[model samples]
Target: MSINLEQIDELRKRANVSYEDAKNALEQNEGNLIKSLIYLEKQNKIKPDEKPCNDNTFFKNVKSLIKKGNETKLIIKKNDNVVLNICVTLAVIIAISAAPIVIVGLILAIITNHKIRIVKKNNEDSQVNKIFDKVSVVVNKVTTKINEELKTE
Candidate 1:
């Protein structure tokens, strides 16, 4: 059956899609009446199968990739400047609490002992950078995929 602008206008009104959108889809299907319907159906931006493409092949791949990221508890984190300050403060608190007896504490306080400082520093941050780095990677990967898809569509 032949489909024309008038018929498309009717369908577009029924579909609640813009005239431009209907026109484009109609043109893209190259005048094939059934193909246009199928295209709209596949997009799920239409009735009959209005449920969006939730578990589509693309999302399934993304979910699998995320699962891989979760296989190890390693996660990158957002760069929050305040977190750095907190890490430094906690390290100092723990160091003071673990201070040896009053005598040794006085000695440690007097000396510029670098070893204890290093240990406290590691404990305070607790690999915050490593986790954030992983998160950033995941975000970039997902963003790249989304951008690529948008470009193609």
Candidate 2:
């Protein structure tokens, strides 16, 4: 079925575009909502895609994004078994009562353990991972450097 008039109207409101523009985009794109949105966005007509910004749909999308973000945060905040164990072992090896080592170890443990969790979560979340993948490389680099420095010292 073609995109309905109500939906087009809603999109117009959400996107903050003129009635004629929204109608033309949807009609020109032939029921392809994403294409219509892309057209509008490319033409500098809207805010370049949002959560649709209406009722349950927008809120649900927001919640899903929040959930995805939270899951990612959890993954970045946990440590894998090997990393955690190594952290604990290092703390012990570093000093008798090395508070700094222990704390750092704990932090690393929390960070690396999150990897698998985030990976698993990405499989379930569509756009969530796309957003994160963009920044993953930089984050990985910083974390790797931190790990290397900690190991050396």
Candidate 3:
């Protein structure tokens, strides 16, 4: 039996099967949509229906990212001495829960000549550390200028 592209596409969308699989199933089932679905199900070609806006997949991706973040450490140092060290996931949680305090603490850390570093698992350097370093340099320059102006007043 001959099957049109529309039938194959409809079956593919409904069963989440590939184009060839859908076309084969439709042809084998005499171009009947319901029978094609059943044929695909029997062949184990049909997968669990995943909607376009799938929340389960979204949550799974978020969980994976958080796991990676927990494996990575955020380190704050001053004078080559470790001042604070915590997992990135926990730091994010704390920052979210206390945004103002986190901002003030970060500003103070920069003002006090502290270094912010991100260390991945296996002690690999993170690219985020470069951004932190640049920001710290800019903030230090501004603070120093402000202090000089205050002293001259």
TM-score of 2: 0.28
Best by TM-score: 3
Residue-level lDDT tens digits of model 3 in 1-153: 678898988998899999999988988889999999999999998998765664688888998999999999989999999999999999999999999999999989988889999999999998988999999899999999999999999
Winning model by lDDT? 3
Against the hidden true structure, what lDDT does model 1 obtain? 0.52
Give candidate 2 regions above 4 Å deviation: 1-3, 47-153
User: Candidate 2: how large is its RMSD?
Assistant: 16.9
* Least well predicted 10-residue stretch by lDDT in candidate 1: 112-121
By the lDDT metric, which is better: model 1 or model 3? 3
Which window of ten consecutive residues has the lowest lDDT sum in model 2? 82-91
Reference-based TM-score of each model: 0.26, 0.28, 0.61
**What tens digits encode model 1's per-residue C-alpha lDDT throughout 23-142?**
767888886646776777678756543556865889989767655433323211223222122233344345577755634643433232111121122233335555544554565666
lDDT digits (tens) for residues 1-153 of candidate 2: 476889788768777788888888988898677788889988888954443456567788877765654454223333333222222223334546777875675345434433322343444544545655545555677788999999999
Model 3 regions lying over 4 Å from their true place:
1-55
